[model samples]
Target: MRVPRFCCFLLLAIAASAYADSEIPFAAFELADSTDFTTNAEKNLWLLAEAAATAGDTAGNTQRASLDLRWEASLNRQWRAGFSDRVDGHFSQDLKQSDSLNTLREAWLSYRLTPQTLFDAGRINTRYGVALGYNPTDFLGRGTVRSASSADPEMLRSNRLGNAMIRVQRFWDRAALSAIWSPKISSKPATSSTSLDWGASNPRNRLLLSGSYRLAENLNPQLLLLQEEQRSPQFGANFSRVLSRQVLVYAEWAGGRQPLAWQEALPRQQWQVRWRNRTAAGVTWTGENQLSLRLEGHYNGLADNSRALAYLSAAAGSGGGQNTTPVVTEWVAPRRAALLQAYWADIFDRYDLNIIWQRDMQRGQNLGFAEVRHHIGPVDLALQWQKVFRLSTHSRVLAQADRRWQLSIGYFF
Candidate 1:
């Protein structure tokens, strides 16, 4: 019998906690139900076998129950360990399997080589970027997401798989440097719910180097270089500045020689490599009323609207069973976009509101999401709504809309 990988990590965390100075354990249970509404144009496109795989996801009611667990321990003065895991059970009215999925979000060990240096190994959820709506410099985030219940960018980033890597960091008074190496573990992605899914996180051997420096009292900048097997190296940079006590600005950029987005999705298509750039710039303002507002602009040189339409048209006509819808919808970046966001904390006692609006400039489509949450003691309740407008064809852009509503109840212990 083969043992599950997360069970090993759980045992390790327990063993380390026995002799650790401090150990923290966290657990949470949540139940959510979602309803989706799809337009006629979208239903027509789903006739293709390639898009049929996701047809069940378009218009249905899905209910999910989830349990989240986390453990962190400080072993003596030189060592530390952490682990996070989530289990989900999903049910729906549409004919399908009642799936039970488990995700190992993080499992890592850290050692203090010196007071100013550190070493880390195992699966780590390292994140990089300064923009809130979009992140162009987050190179390690590709294909790492296992499951997402919410469309909120923050929630998507928090509940994703972490890559297995060895990392080293050195810190100084005004600067820091980090290096990471991740090795390939599997050639294909796993299909089982209980799988560790190492292929999604570490599909190829990769190396990353990052450094950050504080140039002024309110300005800090970070630079990065990433190299993967059989691919050209990519360069990235990000910077943030505090303009005033209640105002801030940030920018993130990445550039590399790569094939176009559509070509990457359709492997049979001719490949052309050229220099491309992706960028995001944003500013935020906070008021005394505990409300924060933000505006951001995004650009991607590798994406062309016409090519994206052609790709969709081809997929809609193909008879293959392979699902390429996810690649086009989730992985491909828009050529030009804009985002607006508003967050109000403590609007009422123990209540919060969040709203996000994004516009695709190239396709002239829009998406909007809003959520209202209430907290009472150890339990929380939330209601969320999302609206998405998508393009349908290459000749004429048909506006197809999909709306979704979700309600959630959660308890933390």
Candidate 2:
């Protein structure tokens, strides 16, 4: 019996090493095959440049660009190095010249532990989104320089973790857990008004809990519960299945706090449901012009009173990309009470779209957007436009409609 147990342990150790080897090889293969990340072994570097222009009302911004470079070094299967340099050419007419080289996007070690658990400790990039897609809905973007430029972004933890933590993942298992508890935040405020930035985040504990289970063949269910600021984000559930070879369906509903304030961590108390179907994962899985459709609706609990006006007002004046801002700027509250309701109707599968709808306790809002994108060979082209209108206000009557458009061309080799 003792001999048999020892042999089993040895076999398991070998299997774990094999699994680690598999991941690094696939990454390397994709790098060499034309998915980007490939370069001469000596000077392994690549450059990326992007520019966007937007117009609306009496304001228009143009000529925003970024100089991105990546250094890929694979030091065996267990050790890999990646350095990402981002020089922000934030030239939007009024903005100052903002350009600099950032830290290592990924400089870590991947040690196999029992062919399932992986110990990845360093400044690494992580994705909490589904299918690892670029859509913000699939997974939220935390450390994106472009996304943070938004007038009102969520209070988020930095993208990279400084402390050491272990992640044990089993692919295609009945269930899986991907969680992180880190000493990353420097501070913790009591509520939104006292929230701190990622660097100085309240020392209060924060985490994201996501798990999925296989109920049956053609039926997979998933749940995401996050405690960014509040105790736990509202709950969301998703189910996937096949109707036929041509039709697939995904329907999901989520209820949780609004993760806008770091200190107060107000709960939005809203529910959202969406259904989407596409031919395949990437663009054109079956035909030349394969299309995807998606519809999502949200119901926010503003029973306590809608403070969106004040919150947004503070966000507009909020500055400093690396620091946190107070959630409550003015001691003002709306007079009316209503539940916010809105939805999105979307198509154009490639790179998809981001349509946001905002409302108050009494009435709903409608935001408009249109986008077109195509990737031919190694070049990509994209065009997009967005319009937003603030609906039903008690203190402030109504804000002006805002529109933004962007046209971009990118080359990858």
Writing each residue's lDDT as its tens digit, candidate 1 over 1-413 gives 00122222121111111101111111100000010111122111111000011112245677777877766667779998877777777776564757877889888999999999999999987778757667788888776778766677766665688899999999999898999999999856676899999988898999999998879766668899999998899999988776776776778999998877656655634668889999999887766665667899999776775676666766666633144443443433568999998876557775767888989888787878887877664455777787765444422332356677877776654
lDDT of predicted model 2: 0.37
Name the regions of candidate 2 deviating beyond 4 angstroms: 1-46, 69-74, 79-85, 92-108, 123-166, 171-173, 188-197, 200-204, 207-209, 223-236, 252-288, 300-306, 310-363, 374-377, 389-400
lDDT of 2 at 286: 14
Alpha-carbon shift of residue 179 in model 1 (angstroms)? 0.4
Clashing pairs in 1: none
Q: Give the alpha-carbon lDDT of every model.
A: 0.66, 0.37
Best by lDDT: 1
